[model samples]
Target: SEPFLPFTAQKLVELFGLEAPDWTQAGNGQLLKESSSIGQMGLLFEKIEDEVVEKQLNKLQESKKMNEAANAPAVPMKEIITYDDFAKLDMRVVTVLEAEKMPKSKKLIKLKVDTGLGHRTVLSGVAEHFEPEFLVGKQVTMLINLAPRKMMGIDSEGMILMAEDKDGKLKLLTPHEGTASGSTIS
Candidate 1:
């Protein structure tokens, strides 16, 4: 007859959230030697503990670096350019005759601009920063000679000039006062 142990180590196993260790060898009809199995289990637990500690340390370091970057000062200026290089740009004032958001697009707005040469389509990716209704009748500066490119199935004839601030706020570079459309910017 087999002896019955009334109190096994089940409570102790549950206290450490551990499953009861299996003592049988896998699929070989043999029992695993006890002392070697205990050593291997201890090594596995040590590896898991080391990995958890490393992950927590990395997270803490990343958070500290992010806070430091958020408090940093303004960005450094770009490389200098000469006036002769700047003179190559054919900048002109254009009046927005019509503006509307492009269908099926998130960032594109179709604008009909009067270039003094003629009325032309201008596709600007500034829908998130400016409303279409706010752009109508506004005289804005543009680079007139850029090659026409198709964006969202609309032909963009020119590039509208805008100034972006440090916090990603965009402001179109418009005439301080009313200016004639197609007038060259000196």
Candidate 2:
């Protein structure tokens, strides 16, 4: 039988009802030096500890990256357009003449706005973020040249410009000072 290391002898006795081999009487009658076994075990344990610590650090770094990505913009920047293409947009300042939440919808708001051209109906998906009364008489940016579209049985004449934060909160875009109802926004 091969000579058993001192530590293996104790474990073998505890796990199985087997007698420990006498290392001094085994093949060649030589026992492994206890100091060498202890040193190897210590090195093995140190390697295991290092691997565990590295795994923990990797997990922490991945968690930090996930948090940063959550706070970043939801969409990437759009493709750039030429100056003439941008100039084609009829963006202007408009005053909210009247506002009300649309029927049968939680997100839509029906608004009447003065685009300096005329009073027009603009449907915006902002009812969840803003109250109808809060929008009344507020001067806001509008894209006035968009082809009119029908929503919920109403013709939406333009689109209200809004800003969104990382948390998905929406805010209407407005000028710093009060602007005329129909002022052009260059």
TM-score of each: 0.58, 0.62
Q: How does model 1 score by TM-score?
A: 0.58
* Deviating ranges (above 4 Å) for candidate 1: 1-75
lDDT of each: 0.80, 0.82
**Candidate 1: lDDT over CA atoms?**
0.80
**Model 2 Cα lDDT, one tens digit per residue, 55-155:** 99999999987798687867787999999999999899999989999889999999999998899999999999999999999999999999999998889
* Best model per TM-score: 2
Write candidate 1's Cα lDDT for 29-137 as tens digits. 3334334233222221224587889999999988887777677677788899999978988899999999999999999899999999999999998999999999999
